[model samples]
Target chain A: MAELFISISIWPWLAYTLAGLVQVTLIVTLVAVGALVFIWLERKVSGRIQDRLGPTRVGGRFGWLQTLADGLKLLTKEDLMPEGADEFLFRIAPYVSFCASLTAFLAIPFAGGSYPFVALHMNTAVFFVLAVLGLEVFGVILAGYSSASKWSLFGAMREAAQVVSYEVPLGMCAVVPVLLAGSMDLVVIGDRQTGTFWNWYLFHDPFTFITFWVYFTCATASVNRAPFDLAEAESELVAGFHTEYSGLRWSFFFMAEYGSMLAVSLLASILFLGGWNGPIPVASLLGLTFENGFWLGFAGNVLGTANLIGKGVAGVTVMMWVRWTLPRLRIDQVITTCLKYCVPIAASMFVGATLWQYAFPNGAIFPQSAAAYQVREPWNAKAEAKSAEAARVEKTASREPVATEFTSGRTAEAAPLSARTPDPAG
Target chain B: MEAPIYWPTFFFLLFSAIACAFAVAVVVTPNIVRMAFYLVLSLAATAGLFFLAGADFVGAMQLMIYVGGTLVLLVFGVMLTSQDRFISMKTSGFELGVAVTLGVCLFVVLAYCARSIPEWHGMKAKQVSAVPLEPTAAPLGMGLLGARVDGPDRSGYLLVFEIISVHLLVVLVGAAYLARARGKKNLLVE
Candidate 1:
């Protein structure tokens, strides 16, 4: 019954559209709700971090609904347009940024196997995410350029420059994880590290451990977060490219930022840490397989999803900590960090990992036996078929007593095998 | 003996339509920044087209290297070089006429050649369906690592992949060298 419910209709494309719409809705809602919750959390966290009580008057004892109230205020505020601003581009920029942020999730696999909770289950999902993430810069660029304000233009230009430069090291860092996994499918990569915590890419090797840090630096820079957020430098550009924005539109920019923050954090989680796999294999040991009863399987998946979200949240929390703690890097310094430091480190790590993989086909640091705890029969039909063929061939070649080769033709092989048997033996 | 119009042919048609449309838009648009923006959309669509054409590796390449890296750089150039003069290039009437004449002629010849192919015209629409646009990453990877033994039963892209990688490295270094501010900044690491 559940399989029938999950199955698509005959015309595949109708199913495609339905699935795409559902995934988009899911990601959008989650991101929107997440943004609301995160905004409040950030305020609360910063408040505690800076030794003050943040927003204690909106909804409850802790002002838990402050973000909601703030959102309402933003929605009610008047929309303004500065003189000389390119009207079309200005209006479109935020949506473009917001859309780019949302679209990356279309390719990201949340849970399940090959056909996962991903919107578009493209083989090049990892590539698609990086491409879409890079596109977020365009909206910033458009917002800055079309604003007709010098500060806005400056901010946009800085963002454009920073993001483009940062993508190099980011790509290099990303390749390390892909390299280790031996496949670009995020579902495959995530599933490979299934059994335990140590199976994560961060612990794949010493080089990967270093690569994770490099990846984080690039991610921070790419997202225009603190220490690399010269584009929105408060002192210089007067809130940078988004200076012209207000109310809901301004909130849209923040939503995009937070959305992207969650995304990159998730990327780090999947690439470095074992995605949907906890520190302990309690679920595994408890006999919770996908083949288990529906309720049991669902409970297992829910636990895994919670685990993935927790890892992602931890990554976001780390980003917030870094934001509050470290001072923003200068534009030159940020570029230097990427081009000189991150790039070289990522490149060397890539090379080191390559050599390591060759020298030790099996992972040296951790046990491969643990990696194999979750048995992944990689959907390799061809390999299985070939093996089956070889087995059949061996059976045919040998002096087999009763070789009923039923790999393909059961009737033909069975009839002949029975006929070949002597009457006495029968 | 008759040759068949394979899946790649249909993909070529679809991709060419999109790539040509967006490329023409880039050429037609006068505003430099708008031109850059249009170019981004075009290149991305082209990347999609590449994926459709069973060049999954190239499609990812188109996205990662082209749209993400090159086009972003192009947009930055648009932002930077977009200071005063030449914000929009208004071509002269004569130049426009000449350009249009050549473009039409080239397109006509190409279209004529495409139509002239009997083998290409022979296949049914269903027979010419592309190598499913969904989940092309694995075959592409196999092609790259030189082990396309199964799925597509096609040859790997090792030699070209290697060359493209090397080419990308060169392009990176060259672009950096060219774009880097002279003397005022830290140009050399060593």
Candidate 2:
């Protein structure tokens, strides 16, 4: 998009600014719309689970516009601040949370390949996303501290402990895919499993299969979702961190929650599931690739985007299902789940996966040597090969002239390291 | 026609301004919690500066380890230590003078080192843009694993990496031991 603006050659800085605005608008819209849809979906899902109807009168029989109606009400509602609350921190807390949650979407690619649909194409996208996502806790902490309520302080403390603990296992679980793909770039990881369903890292080995579940558990806990949402346990903490918040400000926290839920779900899909690649390579089968034509590539990317979003939504739905079905764990239980179960399980899986990779370097078993089962080399293969060539050229260029007999003898094989050093006379 | 605005310089100035302003705020603020918040913003702006300087990995690490992790822990510690409202710690004039002297000396040394490098002097826009975006992750990984991919003539930092990691592990173990409950004294003796 920036390239398009630059090509026009009209106020280049303005073009860059406009391009940035467009990207920000797109990501913010996605987060807002996602929050709306997910809130409605959550209510509906919970209603079904509890054997009741939710928001039947808001928009229609199905109440499709329930979230929108709720949003409107929130906007019109009074914005109140506690007399003891720190005015500045209290006012900015929700925006901080929302911004951190939204910024994570920048590095996440919605599609893969030569033309990936990412706002910011980062080499270390997985790490960047996780890092930014962790910043969301600041908002909660600030909100809690500034609110001057004991309950809010307790909630913030619980959150600080929980998030800090969960990050350990969460990072370990995330690294398994990075190890398998030999790259931290999400596009590279996604491109590796381009062929079929079995190519998904979740099914690559028994360890990773177990790791996926562990990752999900840690991810769930890290995002503060039930059955691990001790930070905002309503029955005990009375709305927890955001107790003093109301109106649009309170809604920002909710949006941040759903935004992070969607972000982690998307990351999980890209890491463990086939990412933009479908169970069956529908785009490939239909010959819709960049190699064919521009339109074909566009179609392929569109399809890939749908595939990724579908997988992410599926993950979110599963989270919702779990949230509705299971009861929230106590604070101690939540910590134990992270440290005792998730951490140990993730660590062992890391070791097992490393060993599995060594034993079966091809990333397949039972049907080894089959051309179809071979993992595709990452997109950086060409660059690496070029670098290797450059290294070889450098080595040859630096070689010193030796005695005639020695040179003749060593011509068949590569010269020793010492002899390769450049002489004063070339 | 000349471009109206240079984007990189604009962003660099913006980030540096924010970092400097927030850092001042951190020192000036009387409220401890508000001071912590200012420190967070300052550190975050410094991370932005890192990103602008083409150190993406370092920027992300700064955000993760310093701004996100360490500062959160700092806030948690502050909260635990002082639960009173509007708590502030006042420093003596001697302490402030000492700190200012040390900071100035350190700044002078850093400025001298930066000035010693010929390449650090005025660079043209063309020179800046001529350098293509290089992926630092692969070479960084190789360097850590005792292989110098950037320049094969140089030795890798694998030993240093291992030593630092082990040092960190020892520190973590020591911290855990110190923080552990005293009720398990009998078990420890056993």
Candidate 3:
């Protein structure tokens, strides 16, 4: 580790590489930290809603250290296994949940303009995030089923049904923004919304305006938040899926829950709201050009990072308030709400957005659309034209033309191999 | 999109171990709930295999629909049917003996075919080329939308995509219908 750090210190490429690793480590840390904050926040929110003071002693004012204390206590407790439980499945389930939750962070872009700020930068990031998020239910199911308790099994069943039912509308709502952006890339979606608050897709078109609410409802359900948290409905299920789980294992599930809540919120900010894009175009106005402006871009990125985190925190706070203020829905009611209401609404909004995008291809419904926020350096028309010329040369040199593997062999690039393969003409 | 063989080799080995072990446990475990649990693990690991083979869509589909959806439904079925923790339906020792012998024979034949195939074993020590990792969303989205706008133009996988969409809708309806309790009879009648 020391030698590796030394090399990173010496070489600029190594510094960049180290920076990339730090970005990933930082996201994981943020999720861990966010989980701590949200759990505390949940308690406080629930407390105020229920007419009580929650966690006032730990870490001064707001009980900021309360989560850490709870975590330590959980760690010290005995790891229990119930009779008739599948040992391997029981042991592995929580890790699976945590893994799925953390993996979704890979595709989320915290800042719009920069290198290594984003974890995955997948072209299909929105889909990828949604897809991975769906996997978290398996762990919950496993935990409940393997617990050998009726309560646990019941909780798992409710969650399974809820997640599956909600995914239809959740997917529909997610696609509305994708349609408006003309790309599935989350960064592009965020950048497209980079001028004023009104530029956010929530105000883009009438359909998008409506789509935001549908998305929020579906997202809340997807994360098993209030009005839809029938999965872990404590009053009904007697502690639900984790009824048999004590100590560290139980905490893992909550951490996973908080992590997912934050993830969905971050996704919301990126898709419906302006992600890292603040209400003002500060970075662009300050002249953070791509070339010969690395430090300025870096500083802008740091500011955006702070902004994104602030937005994410604000979203989690809103969700907490909703959870506390609203009553939990029955499992049937939860599924009914998602399918009967959220699904149809999201579908209608999607169709409306598609028509709107079709009609107004480049029409700026808000100021952000024309804010001149940073675009990706490569993949522009000039570069596209150059690559087109290169393709022409390749076409003449071959009897049967190939798919033109120009950037494919170049290996390390921000974009995926699939992106470069598609001819402009096609 | 050649994954460094390190990934596939490690993944294939892990997948084979988990899948084989879980499959064996499924047969050996007396309790029905235990069998169901083993089956979920086995299928979940197979989803990982799908991911390793670069079928991200299929992997997610398996997780979201099969393991996450179907398996959860199956677990519910097991819970609903079971009156006891270990719900064992016994098969005779003679039946087990015969099945094991036959299974071993089939495995040998399968292993021979897999090991002997030139294409399968051709890249014994091949350098895993890093796949130019772009966001597969657009092409995948386009492919699903009946457009062959990217990749090796074999006219897109829109048919498969649409087929799955219809299939999932049907599956949801059929499974709900099948799993629903009749007014006169319980759903899990066993």
Candidate 4:
């Protein structure tokens, strides 16, 4: 979109800014709409599980407008601040949490092809997502502390310990897929798992299969869902860190929670499940790959996006099911489960997967050939081409003598870096 | 007409300003919790600077380990040590004056050193803007695993990586020991 404006003689800065705004608007809409849908889905799923009709009256039989109604109610409610609360911290905590949750989405690719759809493309996207996700705990802790309530404090403390502990194993679990794919880029990881379900990292090896479960457990715990939701144990800590929050401010925390839940689920789907790739290569079979024209490539991407979202939503549904069905673990149990079970299992699986990869370099089940396993250099190729073009332009611009020779020298230096650093697999 | 705004430079200025402002806020905030919060904002903005400098991996690590992990530990410590009584500890005027003078001196020295670097200055705006956003993850991973993939002459970080891993293990053990709850018998033993 920015390129379009730039091509049409608009100022580069304005075009870029407008493009960025559009991108942010799209992402915010995705989160907000996803949250609304997930809330409604959760109620419906929970109701069905308990053999009850959830919200039948709101938006016809399914009550699709329930979340909308809830949002309106929340907006109208008095935004209450605790008497002894730190006003600034209390006001900003939810935004911090929401922003952290939202930032993780910037690195997440919804689809993969010649031009994958992502807000920002980071090479270390998995790590970036995990890191941003971890920042959400700060907001929780601040909310707990600033609320000046004992229950809130307890909830925050529990969250602090739980999230910090869970991250260790969660990280370890995530690395197993990175190990399998041999790249930290989530798009690359997702692309490597293309073709079929068997190609998914979860089914790649026995160790990875086990690692996926461990990843899910730690992911669930990391997101503070039951049975690991000791941070918000309603029976004991009222509403946990959010005990003092009311109305829209309270809803923001939930939005952050649901957003992170969806993000983690998406990450899980991308890492363990086939991501945008389904059980079968429907798009490829339909000749909708990038080799086709632009429209067909877009169609493929759309299909892929749908597939990825379906997997993510499925993961979220499972989480909702677990939340409804299982009993919340005690704080001690949560800690023990992470330390004793998840961490050890993840570590052992990591070791096992490493050894497994060493034994069968291609794969055990599918046994893809070396040629088939060749890492794609498309991103590098495009980057190199762009840098070369940029260097040529810089050279021409430098001939005018207004621009310094240092600029040309720097461009020349950058050209080699971009061109030569193709594949670091060796 | 005015010169076109360089977006990257504009963003760099924005991030740096936020980072510097929040760093000062961290020092100025009286409440310990508020100080920690400010420190987080400062560190996060610094991470943004790292990202702007095209060190995405380093930026993420800064966010994860420093802002996310270490600061959480600091906040936990603050919460455990003094919930209400020491929430806002007032520093002595003399100490504050000394700290300010020291900080000013350090900043001046750092700024002088930063400005002294020749390669850091006079880069072509076109060149800076044209640098491709390449994924540094692979080269970083390879370097960690004892392969100098980024450059032919450069050395790998294998030994340093191993040492860091060991150091992390030691730190973990130390933390576990320090945090271990004492029984009646252990108290007597102590």
By lDDT, who's the top model here?
4
Candidate 2 chain B lDDT trough over 10 residues, lowest sum: B145-154
User: What DockQ does each prediction reach against the true complex?
Assistant: 0.27, 0.37, 0.25, 0.35
Model 2's lDDT to the true fold?
A: 0.83
**lDDT tens digits, residues B1-190, model 1?**
7865454566668777877787898888888877777787788778777776556667777877777778777777776677562377799989999999999999999999999989877556665464333444554454465544343334556666777899989997998899777784555732
In CAPRI terms, where does candidate 2 land?
acceptable
Model 4 CAPRI rating: acceptable
Instruction: Write down the worst ten-residue block by lDDT for model 1 chain A.
Output: A400-409
Q: Candidate 4's error at A365, in angstroms? A: 1.6
Off by over 4 Å in 2: A366-426, B1-4, B92-119, B183-190
C-alpha lDDT (0 to 100) for residue A288 of candidate 4: 91
Tell me each candidate's i-RMS in Å.
13.7, 7.5, 7.8, 7.4
For candidate 3, give the lDDT of residue B180: 74
Model 2 over residues A1-426: C-alpha lDDT tens digits? 788798989677777788889988989998999999999999989999999987688777889999998999999999999999999999999999999999999999988767788889998888899999999999999999999888888899999889888888998999999987767888888877787888888888999999999999888888889998888999999989999889999999999999999999999999999899899999989999888987898899899988998898888889999999999999999988888899999999999998887676665653321322112122133333445653343334322111221222223333343343333345
lDDT of each: 0.75, 0.83, 0.75, 0.85
Q: In angstroms, give how far residue A244 of model 1 lies from its true place.
A: 1.1
- lDDT, candidate 1, A1-426, per-residue tens: 122334843344455456556767789997898899889888888888899998899897989899999999999999887888888788988998998899887777776542355666666677778888888888898899888888998898889888988888888888887876766777767776777777888888899999999899889889998877899999888999999999888999999999998899888888888887777866667866566666666667677777888888888888887887898888889888888888888899999988886676567878554323221122233343556763455345232211211122222122332233233334
Query: Can you give the lDDT of residue A364 in candidate 1?
Result: 87
Strongest candidate by TM-score = 4
Clashing pairs in 1: none
Worst 10 residues of 2 chain A by lDDT: A398-407
Name the regions of candidate 4 deviating beyond 4 angstroms: A369-373, A376-426, B83-86, B116-119, B129-133, B185-190
- Candidate 2 lDDT score at position B55: 85
